[model samples]
Structures are given as C-alpha cells and as structure tokens.
Target chain A: MSRVLSIVTGANRGFGSSICQEFVKFSPNKEQHLDFILFARSADSLKNTKESIKTLSKVANVIEEYGVEMSDIPQVEKTFKDCLDKIEWNKYSKICLVNNHGTLYNLDKIDTFTDFQHIQKNNDINITSFVTISSLFLRKVKALPNFKDLEVTMVNITSLAAIKPFESWGLYCSSKAFREMFSNVIAEENKSSPNFKVLNYSPGPLDTDMQKEVRETCSSEETRQFYLELKKNNNLVAPGDSARALAKLVFTYEFTTGQHIDYYDIKEK
Target chain B: MSRVLSIVTGANRGFGSSICQEFVKFSPNKEQHLDFILFARSADSLKNTKESIKTLSKVANVIEEYGVEMSDIPQVEKTFKDCLDKIEWNKYSKICLVNNHGTLYNLDKIDTFTDFQHIQKNNDINITSFVTISSLFLRKVKALPNFKDLEVTMVNITSLAAIKPFESWGLYCSSKAFREMFSNVIAEENKSSPNFKVLNYSPGPLDTDMQKEVRETCSSEETRQFYLELKKNNNLVAPGDSARALAKLVFTYEFTTGQHIDYYDIKEK
Candidate 1:
C-alpha cells in the first residue's frame, strides 16, 4: 500500500487547523499510512494543531510542524524544499498542497491605502508567496520517481471577493482574483499532465479570524452589516464543517481541476 | 474660453507621449489653451518629450515636465498634489488624468521568479501607484470650486492582459486586472455623481517599448512567436494611431463610465 502526504498552510487556527483535523480523521483504514506537514507563524500554535491531529488520527501518521513567515520568501522556499527533501517521495501515492494562508491587512479603501510599503507588504504575504510556494511544490513533485503514478493536487483557497467587487476590500479582492487567474493559467499549462490537478476553492464565509477582521474593520456600512448579519443569524459556516466539505471535494476521485468551486458546489454534488 | 489641463504618466516616449500629442493638437480653435504635465523617470527624457510637444502643438500651450519615480508613493502623491495646487481650478473646463505608466519588469514564469522582493516591487510600481494617483486626482477635483461644472475624467490605460491570461506575464496581467476592477469600483462609487467619470481603457497592442519587452522576454514559445509575428507583419498599431483612437473615445460626449472598453469597441461605434 502507498502512503499519503498532506501539506497545509495557516494550520495554527481557523479553517487551516480544521483542514488538518479533517485529513487526519478522514479514513481509519490501515492500508495507507499518512504524513502531515503543517505551516503556520508560531511554533507553539502549530504544536496545538499537531496534538489535535494525533488525538483524532486512527491510522499511524507522521505529523511535522514549521513556523512559516510568509513575508520572508527565501526562508519560506528553503523550509518547503527542506521538508520535501527530508521525506521519501516514492512512498506516497498521493501528495497535496493546500495554500490556506491569506491576509486582509487593512479595510481602508484602495486609494486611501496609498502607501506603497503597506500595499507591497500585503501583496508579498498574500499573493506573491502563494505563487512561490505553489511553484516550488510543483517542481518538487515533478522530480519524484514514478510521479505520474501518484496523484498530485494543488488547492488555492479563494474568496467571493475573487469574482465580486466589495466596496472596501479592494486589496483582498484583487489579490484573490490574481490567485484564481494564476491557478487558471497553471491548469492550462498542465493540461497534458493527467496526474497533476489545480483547484481554486472558494470556501465560502467560514467563521475564521479573517471574517472577524471584516466584521470589525469594514469601512462601508453595507459590508459591515452583511458580515454582522452572517454572525447574528448564525449563517457563517463553521471551520470544521467547511473543512470537511472541502476535503470531501478534494478527495473525490471525479473532482476536476482548473475549476473555481465553492462549498455549496461540492455539497450539492 | 476655458483651458484644459492634461496630466499623463510614462510620457517620455511611446504611447504616453503620443497621447500627449493627440490632446495638444486635438482642436484647431485657439480659444482653449492647454497645460501638459508629463511624468517620466529622467528630467532630460521628459525635456525631450516637452520639446516634441512644443513642436507639435499648434495652439498656445504651456507644457511642464516632472521626473517621477513611480516606485515612491510619497513622492508621486506630493508631486501630483503640488501640481494640482499650483493650477487655478476654475481655469480649466476639463481636467483629465491619464495613468499610462506601467512596468512589465522581469517577465519570467511566476514560480520560477521565486524572489518576493522583485514581485513586490513590480506590483507596487504598476498597480499601487496607479491607485494612489487616481485617488489624489479625484480628491483634488472634488475640492475644486464649481467642481460639478468642470468635466472630470480619470483614464486608466489597460492592456489585453487585463482580460486575458498570458503565460510568464503573471505580474503584469494581475496588476492590469486590479486596475480594471478598481476602475469598476470607482465608477460604481461615483454613480450618484455623474460629473466624475472613470474609464479603464485598453489601447490594444501598440508598437511600444512594452511590446518590444514582450517579444524579447516571453518564456513561452507561443507567446514569443505571436509578438514576433505582430512586429514582422507590421500588424502592431502605431502609438500615435492608438493615441488618436483612444483620445477620440475619451473625448466622445456619449462615453459611459464603469465600462472596460478597448480600441475596437470604440472604433465600431
């Protein structure tokens, strides 16, 4: 039996942590062992997620955690490459990378947030790093022995902002849009490679830290009220539930790449 | 008897310079005086553009050139604000800003360009500064006496990349997309006030230094060949011709805001 490797970002909290939980508790079968490499900002925070994964896991698994600062691209690339080097690539029949780390740094109107420093910082952390990591992962997997035999999946967590223009969320919206378009381009680039899959997944409005930021910081009354209502009406999807739905969609054998899918899309199917 | 103030970026050469020429020589009537504030990297280069504008302009026009580093937001904002402050707001019947400055810095594959520093720099100069300049222009115009009577227009020069995905041009494509979406949001925000109009204009493939860069740097053979063919077949539109078409669309009385329009879209009208 072949092993499975799952790498995830923002694994210290919210949807990211829940994603780690979902994957760990997913299957109890003894045939395929699992390995988890989680990326987060704090070593202590990752320890908590590592502990939770161990408790829920039934099959024997290896859980590794790293403190990842998205702004430091050099360090990020090195850490990811090192992780790949340490692991035995031939053992895993399935390899997946979930790019879940993102930031809505400021709720100011795009023009009001005029400082290039702030804009550059946000772009680096949210969009550019995501691109770098995705590139590195793809390069690593393609170098593996019998790479075509193993399934390789790349998941980019997208947002409604990717398609919809929110009044005050310009930076967030456009960056997510970039990720979606980049994913589309990547999918097109890899059309000839059947084993490789790219998915831009919009895990709709989860009760995450990002939502809290939106609720608190949004400049427009309409946007503020919309998020407030989601919370007031208990309409926001829980992180765990979203994670389960996302994992279900990801693990589905018939799931196609090059698609921007939402939680409801998977749920309806 | 009202004058016209035209502020343009990347005006040292190429499409930007042509846009300046089109506006200066637009009307044969001597009643409307023109004031041109052109931005570029070097003072000497801007002087050359100014000299050309002086030679081409038939009307009695005042041309001022400013060397601006687009990467520096504070300097860009200050220079723009100073220029606006020096002008008599009521003097010009039309106040227009043309955001034509853009850089396609390092057109390497997104993943292969692993350095976040380079990516961040490109994003800052291309997109963030454009937003800053637009915001400042809008603010300055709104503060003008009898602002509603003066025709205020903000034009963002976009590319085919704004709507289409091209390989190895991730940074350029996404930045243009951001500008397009930003233009949309700005138009929506100003809908209640009709005097303020924002346009995202795709000028098409002009024979500019940018196309030259594309021809030289495109990593994908298909993209490289396409641009090469454009140059070889003399299919690329001249900057002056593109500028005339763009100015025609811009100056058209029936043009609507909130539309992502191109040369063909205007020409067919």
Candidate 2:
C-alpha cells in the first residue's frame, strides 16, 4: 500500500487536535495509509492527540509525537530535522504540512506595552517559527528524488487578522499578514512544480482556547465586546466542524495554488 | 512663527538623505520653520546629510541629527521619548514623521539560509522598530490637550515589495507587508481624529545604494535579470526626483487618511 506523511503543529488541543482526529476519520483507505508526525509544547498532549487519532483510525496508520517549544528556535529546528530523518520518503505517495501553531500575548493596547520582549515572543511564535519550519520542510521536500511524482500540500493556518487588523492585535495581526504574503510568494516561486501546492487557510472564528482566552482576558473593550457578542449569538463554529471542512479542503486537488481559502471559501468550493 | 517637527529615519544617505534635502528645498514659507530630526546608524553620515540640508536651505529651518541603529530597540524607544520630551508641543502647528529606515540583508535564497538571526534582524529593522517608533510618537501626539487642533502625519516608506513579492526577497517582502497592514490598522483606529494621518508610502525603485546592492549582490537569476533590465532601460527613478515628489505628496491637504500612496498613485491624484 502507498503511504502518506502528514504533519501538524500545536497538535495537543483545540483546532490542531480536531484536525488530526478528522484526518484520521476521513483519510483511511485500502490503498493508502498515513504516517503522522505531530508537534506541541507537551509530549503528553501530543500523546493524547495521537491516542484520539488511533481510536478513530483503528490500525490504519503509524503515529509519532514530539514536544517542541516554538519559541526555542534551535529546538524547533532540531525537531523538524529529526522528523525528516525518520520519514521513509520513498514509501509515501503524498505528504502534507499544516502550520497550526501560533501564540498571542495578552490582549493589551500596543501603545501601553511595557516590555519589548512580549513583541519579540509574539513574532517569534506566530511568524518567525512558521518561516523556519516551512523553509526546512520545503527544502527537504524539494530534495526528494522523483519528487514531482508525489503530491505535496503546505497549508498555512491564517486568521481574519491576516486581512483585518484588530485593536489590541497589532503584532498578531501583522505577523499573520506576513504569513499570508509569504505563502503567496512561495506559490508564485514554485508555479512550475505541478505536484506542490500552498494554501493560506483561514479557518474563521472557532470555539478554541485561543478564542476563549480573548473573551475572558482581552483588555481592549472593543475587541472583548466583539468576541462576547459572537458567543452570545452562537456565531462561533465548533472546532470539529471546522477541522472536518479543513481536512477535506487539504485533500482536494481542485483548489488553486497560493489561494487564500476560508471556511466560506472552502464551503463554496 | 509656528514650527513643524519633521523626523526622518535612515537619513544618512540614499532616499532618506534625498528626502531631507528635498524637504528643506520645498518647505520654506513665511508661516512656518521646520525642526528636522534625522536618524541613522552612522554619526558621520547623518552630519553629512544635515550639512547637505543646510546648503539647500540658507536659514529657513532648524536642523538636528542623531545616530540611531534601528535594530537597537531600547535605543530607538529612548531616543523617541527624549525627542518628545524636548519638543514644545504647543509651538508646532504641524508635525511629520517619515519612517524611511529599512535594511535588506545580503540577498540569498530563503531555503539555503544558514543563520536564523539574519531573518530575525530583517523583521526587526523593517517592521518591529517601525511599530515601536510609531507607537511612541502616536502616544505622545494623542496626549496633547489640543491634539485635534494640531496637524500630524506619519509617513511609512514602503516599496513595491509591500504588494508584490520579488524573488530572493522573501524576508524583505514579508516585513514590508507587515508594515503595510500595521499602517492600515493604525489609520482605522484613529479615524475619530481628523488631524492625524498615516501614509504607507511606496517610493518605487530609486537610483540608490539599495538598488545598487540588488543589481550587484542578488544571486537569484530571475531577480538579477529584473533589476538589471530596469537599469539598462533607465527605468529606475532618480532618488532626488522621487524624494521631491514624495515631499510634495506629504504636504498636500487633499490626500485621504490611511492611504497607500505609490509614486503613480500620487501622480494621478
């Protein structure tokens, strides 16, 4: 049977966990099996996620999990290299990388920020780490012999902040915008490579811990009010629903390269 | 007579020096005198720029220059605060800040990059410092008791990279995109105040040292070809001409707030 390699970051909880769960539920087939590599800050969370995936997939796929601190640049780089080393590239007919890990500092006014470290940490986790991880993954994928014969998809999990700027989200919003454009440029650069695709995926507001933190701890009145209203109106999408939709979009071959796909965009597709 | 504070970063040479020289040449009027604050890393280069400005305008404006490394976050913040402390806010009828300082690391393919620090430095000089400097400036400006009565303009010098990504320019391109979005957000947030304006100014390709570096050092065949073609065709705009045009756009009252103005955009307006 042909194998497929799939990697997701922040795989311990929320959208990341749900994404892995849905992928396992939907991707099992008689002709193909998955080799999963998951990343999170805690090994235990990743193990839990792996167990959940195993429960969904039965005995269909192999699973591996790693604890990686996104802010520790060297560790993140080493973990990526280690994962690539262990993957049996020739056995896999397809590979996918989903960048779902990101961090948001306390929602505070940009002007009132007391420490520059917070800004650095925000960019490091949200944007810099994304660049580093993607670069490493792309390098390895491009080096594969007979690479064009295998399918490859790299999905950058973006948010509405990528296009719209929120009041207290100056760093977070700007970093997401950086990723959006970076994804576009990468797509353009690799246009001749038919097997490779890049998608700027905006999953929309989900009932994730990230959103819950915003509703509870956001100091900006305007931002707090907006999230609170979303909850009151039951407007937030469940993580599982969004993940199922996202997994389907990831597997579909009809989407254009370097396209920005949101929940609605994928739904229409 | 009313005073106008004009601050320009990366003012040692290139477009920055030209911008200062052009500002002095154009802004001599009976109603106002400019107090120029020029920033760059080299004290000697800033002194040269100040001397050039003096030669351009006989005795029309007060000139000051400071050697500032944009990569140094603490120094950047301290210098901004010190400048604000010394400024007689009530004396100036208008104030303008031109963020012209940006660094492009030696052009290299993103995948082959061996040093992560280079990427960190690129984003720091291009986007993070811009945010820090602008936040400090805005906080001080808004604190003025009669902030609405005083005219303020924050001009961020962007490039074609802000919208279009160039080959071998991944870090440079993404950083400018971050600044572009950040500028847009700030404009939206300050919409209630009419006296404040933010311009994400795209200066276009100019006959400057940075372009010279691109023509000489760029390793990517596609990028070198594009820039070399511009030079051969004499399509690169002269720094003085672009600076003069940009200064005119900055002084205009008809421009909308939070607008992304390019050389062509302003020419049409």
Candidate 3:
C-alpha cells in the first residue's frame, strides 16, 4: 500500500493543529497510510493533535513530534536534519511540508517600534528560520533515492497583510510579504519538476489566540475596532473551516504552483 | 533663510553617491543652505561624494559622514540615535531621509542555500536595519517642536524585484518586498500628517557594480543573459539619470504620500 508523509510546523495548536486533523478527516484514501511529523516549541504540546488525528483516521499515525525553538537557527537546522535523515524515504509516495509557525511581534505602528532586540528576534523567528527550514527541506527531499516519483508539496501559511499593508501591522506585514515572495521563488525554481507543487495559503482573519491579541493590543484604534467588529459580528473564520479549505487545496492540487490561495477566494468557489 | 537636511545611507558609492550629488545639482532654491549626513561602511569612502556635492552646489555642505555596518543591529540603532541627537532639529525647515543601502546576498536557487549565517546577515542588513533606521528617523523628526511646520520626506530605495519574483533571486526579492511593505505601512501610519511624505522608488536596472555582479554571477542562465544584453545595448540606466528623477519627485512632492513611483513610470511623464 502507498503511504503519505505530512510534516507540519506549529502543529501543537490553533490553525496548525486544525490543518493536521482536517487532512486526516478528509483523506480520500483510507487504504493509504498517513504518517505525520509534527513540530512545535514543545513536543508535549503535540499530544492533543496526535490523539485527535488517531481518533479521526485509523490509517493515520503521528510518527514524530519534535520540540523546536524556531528562533534558534542552529537548533532548527540540527532538528530538521535529524528528522529528515530518519525518515524512511522509500515508504512514502507523497510528502507535504507546511511552513505555518509564525508570530505577531507587536501590534504597534512603525514609528513607535523602539526595542531593537524585539525586532531582531521577530526577524530571526519569522524570516531567518523559515528560509533555513525551507531550504533544508527542499535540498533533502530532492536528493532522495526515488525523488521524481514522489509527489511533493510545500505550503506557506500567508496573510492578506502579505500583499496589503496595515497601519499597526508593520512587522507582521513585512514578514508575511517576505515568506510569500520566498514561496514564489520556490515555485519558479521548481517549475520543471512535474511532481513538485508550492502554495501560499492565506488562512484569513482566524478566530484564534492571535486574533484576540490583535483586537486587544493593536496600536491603531481603527484597526483594533475592525478586529473587534469582526469578533462581535461572529465573522472571523473558524480555524477548522479554514483548515478544511487548505486541506482540500493540498489534496486536489488545483492551484497553479506559487499561487496564493486565500480562504475567502476558495470559499466563494 | 530656510535650510534643508538630507540623510542618505550607502552614500559612499554607486546609486547612493549619485543621489547625494543629484540632490545638490537640482536644488530648486540654490540660495537655501543644504546640509547632508551621509552613511556608508567607511566614512573615508564618502570623500568622493562629499567632494562632488561641494562642486555641484556652493551652498551644500557635508555636515556628517558615518561609517556604519548595516548588518549590526545594536550599532545601527546607536549610530542613528547619536546622529539624530547632534542635529540642530530646529534649524532645518525641510528634511529628507534616503534609505539606499542594500546588498544582493546570493544569486543561487533557494534550495541550495545552506549557510544560515549568510541568510541571517542578509535579513539584518536589508530588513532589520532598514526598519530600525527608518523608525528612528521618523520618531526623532516627529518629536521636534516645529515638526508640523517642517516638510518631512522619507524615500525607500526600492527595486523591480520588490514586486516581481525572479528565479534564483529569492533572498533579494523577499528583502525588497519586506522593505516595500514596510514603507507602505509607514505611509498608512502617517497619512494624517499633511507635511509627511513617503515614496518607494524603483530605480530600474542601473549600470553599476551591483548589475555587473548580477550579470557575472546569477545562477539562472536566462537572467544572466538578460542583464548581459542590457549592458551590451547600453540599455542599463545611468545612476545619475535615475537619481535625477528621484530628486524631482522629492522636490515636486506631487505624488500621493504613500505612492510607489518607479523610474519608468516617471520617465514617460
């Protein structure tokens, strides 16, 4: 029987966890074994995700859970290297890497950003590590013994802020833009590989802890009010709903490689 | 008599030096005193720029030249803070900050990038320092007692790669995108300030050392050839020409506060 491997970062909770569960719940092939390699700040945090995935699909198994500090470049490199090295490459016909771990450095206007340490840390976590991990993943996977035959997909969890600037989301917006463009270059570089796919998926204004933080702490009163209105109107999309759409995109492979697919755009379809 | 203070980074050579020279060459009010603060890796390297500025405009003076390592976050913050503190804030009725320092980290496919240190350095130089300096500039200037009466302009030296993704230019494209988005947020954040102006200027392809590096070292054969053709045909823009257009925009201030005005866009006009 064929097998699939899904490596997900930030899989401990929120949208990341939802993505893992949805992928298994909606799997088209019950006969195929689905293995997961989950990464978060703590391996222990991935317990709920592992339990939920097992409950949803008997074919699914949580193969590995890594405790990783994404901001520490050296550690990130070491952890990913060990994980990829241990993977039984020949056992899986499909592989997907979801680069989803991120943070809101602060909800403040650009002029007011004074803490240089905070800024550097934000870049280290969001841009440096993301690039480092993505580079490692592509290099390792492409060198596999049966590389051409395996279907590969890379997803970047992006945002509307990636393309549009927001008043108080200076750091967040720039980092997202960086990731989206990086994903674009990946798509362009791998265009010749028929079995390779790249996607930038914007999960929308999710009703997650991040959203709550945005509503409470945004420096711009107007922006904060906007999020508050979204919350009050019950308009923020559920993590599961957005995750299901993302899962559908991953399985169907309907998107043009490097295309950015937002939850609303897919929902309208 | 009104005075203008211009702070320009990467002013030691290339397009940066051209901007300093052009600003003096095209000053509308020749009688008005012009003061410049130039930054580059070595203050000694700024001799040519300082000399040329003096030759172009009798009233123009190189007030200060700072040697800065753009990749060092703490140093970047300290240098800017010290520079801003020494400025006679009340003396200048017009201030313009030209953020022009940048680097091409590499010319290879993203998958082949293995040096995590190189990636971190690129982000430090391109994104982190840019934000740090810009924030410092804005905060310092805005706090002036006469800020409302002063004309404040912020120019981000952006590029075509900022909006378009190129194969084998992953790091460069992503950093530019980050800067452009950050500039957009600056525009949005300060829209209510009538005297404030921000511009993201894409100077087009320039005949410079950077372009030479591109032609010789680009990993993509097609990209290298395209740049080579531009050089052979003398199609590459002269730094002086593009700098003149940028100066025109600064002086005219006809553009919307947050507009991205490319050289080609203005050349047609």
- The C-alpha lDDT values of all candidates are 0.78, 0.81, 0.93
Chain A alone, TM-score per model: 0.95, 0.95, 0.98
DockQ sort, best first = 3, 2, 1
Clashing pairs in 1: none
Q: Show the colliding residue pairs in model 3.
A: none
Of candidates 3 and 1, the better by DockQ: 3
Candidate fnat values, all: 0.29, 0.42, 0.84
| Tens digit per residue, CA lDDT, model 2, B1-269 | 77777889998899998988777776748346777887888767787788787676664444556777777778877877887788778978888899999988657766666677667666678876888888888888898997888889999898888788766788788888899888877887787788888888887889798999998988798889999999999999888878878778767645787787888665533
| Model 1 Cα lDDT, one tens digit per residue, B198-239 | 888888888988889889888878889989998999989888
Instruction: Please give the DockQ score of every candidate, comma-separated.
Output: 0.46, 0.59, 0.87
Give residue A126's error in model 2 in angstroms: 1.2
Cα RMSD to native, each candidate?
2.5, 2.0, 1.2
After superposition, which runs of candidate 2 have C-alpha atoms over 4 Å from their true positions? Answer: A28-31, A60-62, B28-31, B60-63
The sequence of per-residue lDDT tens digits that candidate 3 reaches over residues A14-131 is 9999999999976788778999999999999999999999998889999999999988889999999899999998998889999999999999888898898788988988999899
* Shift in Å, residue B201, candidate 1: 1.3
For B21-98, candidate 3 gives per-residue lDDT tens digits of: 999988898899999999999999999999999998889999999999999999999999999999998899989999
Worst 10-residue stretch by lDDT in candidate 1 chain B?
B56-65
